[model samples]
Target chain A: MSKNSSNPFTVPEGFFEEARSRAVAGASEVRRRRRNAGIALISGAAALAIVVAAGTMMRSRTAARLYDESAGWLASAEYDVFLANELIYENGMDY
Target chain B: MDRVDQRFEKIVQEYSEPLYWHIRRLVVSHEDAQDLLQDTLVTVYRKLWQLRDPSKEKAWLFRCATNVVNHFFRRKKRELGDRTLDEYLEQTLRDSEYVNYTEAAGVKLQKGLLTLTPQQRTVFTLRYYDELDYGEIARITGSKPETLKVSYHNAKEKLKKIIEEDE
Candidate 1:
């Protein structure tokens, strides 16, 4: 162990260049990360919109089906009552 | 693009080489050192606004770098099921390519450094390699100046003893 007073580490040639490149690369990487995050946000919004639209469409279809069925049932019920009244009138059973 | 961003880049360019060496000495591997240095700069970029007095940026940067190194060890510890930073230092000595201490003194000095606790190693590196004053180191390490002085004093004595023991 000789006089170990001076700094013991020695860097390679072009070390500064290498470090500079790293910082530049790091900055670019930051930009890339931000871009990816933005893309993720947009996709999330799109997914939410799709979910909302699908839910609305399903509700509309269900309401339409129920409306048609109820309308048909009402028409048949009205026809049945009319036939019963006519029969009563024809047979003279007015009571 | 803006003034702050411009200043940040200037800081990166100015400090990268020295910071790399500082990290290299501690981490003892090129890849790890490079990764840590970049991570440190990224943090600096994000947190430069916290630095109210721009003149004290160096100490702030060092503080950030130390935290990054500590964070790396913390992550590694969790991954390895509780490996200590001192143990990591001991294991990585064999992997350090930057240690060109083919000479006996350099080799002995490195061995002595590795033998120290993580805190002592950091204190020594800051004092000897970086030539930072105790007050500056205190600011970076968040330790009292008196405590840093004591640590530096003991670290120097231990290094000498270890080196001399080999002779």
Candidate 2:
């Protein structure tokens, strides 16, 4: 059998032309899908980064506020202790 | 079109018809062959960079086509539960579009070809129809040239007997 030998199969008229077009189109579609997927992956990574940054900022702000409140409470408590000592001393309650 | 797209378009123009015939002979359906050819070309586009040796490009395309056909039959087998590949092909030949039914000998030849094992069928078609040498067939099929020679011989004998018996 040779390449020119006839086989039983027959394609539709103009099938090869159509097949070439379809193949080119199909390859283009694959490239398009890959591009879309790459874009989506990058977008997803970016969105994740933004979410992480926002969460970190919010957490840091909350932490700073909590630290300020704790320091203020400590200062007031120290002043009260000092006042109590002064009252005791002023009240002649020292041993 | 960029360089890669231009290269791919050239490939599609060059190899589509031959690949289509190769796949049509194996699958025995124009629609299936078209779909498989498209898949093969798409695969070639995706993996073209992996082909280092331009001299082996034809063999590589055929190899891709052969893998696609194998995958098709595997998926078809799973879908067809207990119905053999032969049965499926027979049904496809009977009902598929774009087949030349007027050529009784050709149809009989295809049936005979289908009776061979998948390896023998592939080897025979690549050799007999595509006129590929044993080395090229071996490259496409990943078989030793001697092994392909034996398979092709066996397939030829079997098909001869089948066609003669039909006559």
Candidate 3:
């Protein structure tokens, strides 16, 4: 095949240089974005873990407090029943 | 830079002009060609590790370039709602910058090229201008060699008629 010697297109001065730099810079930008995304992913995971741990700790504390309150109420009721029985025996009103 | 970056730089320096012209002939605009070349190079840099055989670098590079050009056309087609790709390309040729109207024959040839379909134009340019063999083009374009030969023949016939009528 016969090759055509004439070219109709023209480029700006230093266009190749400019394009080369831009290409490299664009690759660098991609790398930077990937790195940033990875960092964000790790940070997100860490934050989620912290939140879960805090929630678990708070839930454990709440359960302990509820248990203590229930135990105290049961003890107070037993003490009141024992005192009422003693008063009845003292007054000879207990069969 | 590092070793990989150095290798990428070498690739850019070596293939930039050839790839630019390869893209320019298909896209018909300097700006679009430049952008596509840059995109191609950046892709090459990122995917350089995938290249197991260094012997196929040229074919791989051309493949990347073709893919980028195809994507550009697809996007333009979408943006140009209700209009065909041929019409959009014709408009682009009319309004494109960095073109030499002084080269009347060259300009005429480019116009004739635009008259052909995208596949025909690509096959013709790679075969006629870039002087790539049908096997290489087949690898780059992922088309059968017989198909490319037919496209090139048809493209040549069309361009010949267009040029003959213009004379």
List TM-scores for all candidates, in order: 0.71, 0.86, 0.80
Model 3: residues >4 Å from true position, as ranges?
A1-4, A66-95, B81-83, B94-97
Best-matching candidate per lDDT: 2
Candidate 1 lDDT over residue span B43-120, tens digit each: 887777788997787878888888898788778778776676667766666556655666546656776888777788
Cα lDDT tens digits, model 2, A13-67, are 8888988888888888988999999999999999999999999999999999999
Deviation from native of the Cα of residue B10 in model 1, angstroms: 1.0
By DockQ, the better pick of 1 and 3 is 3
Model 2, range B1-167, lDDT digits (tens) per residue? 77778878888888898898899999988888989998999999999889888888888999999999999999998998989889989998887777678877788888888899999999998998887899999999889999999999999999889877876
Comparing only chain B with the true structure, the TM-scores of all models are 0.91, 0.96, 0.94
Model 2: DockQ score: 0.49
lDDT of 3 at B18: 88
Kindly indicate the candidate among 2 and 3 with the higher TM-score: 2
| Best-to-worst ranking by lDDT | 2, 3, 1
Candidate 1 structure quality by residue, lDDT tens digits, A9-87: 5556786687777776777787689789999999999999999999999999999999999888768978678778988
Q: After superposing candidate 2, which stretches have Cα over 4 Å from the reference?
A: A1-5, A77-95, B95-97
**Residue-by-residue lDDT tens digits, candidate 3, B1-167:** 77777878888888888899999988887878888998898889889889888788888888899999999999988998999988877777777778878878888888899899888988988888878899999999889999999999999999989989998
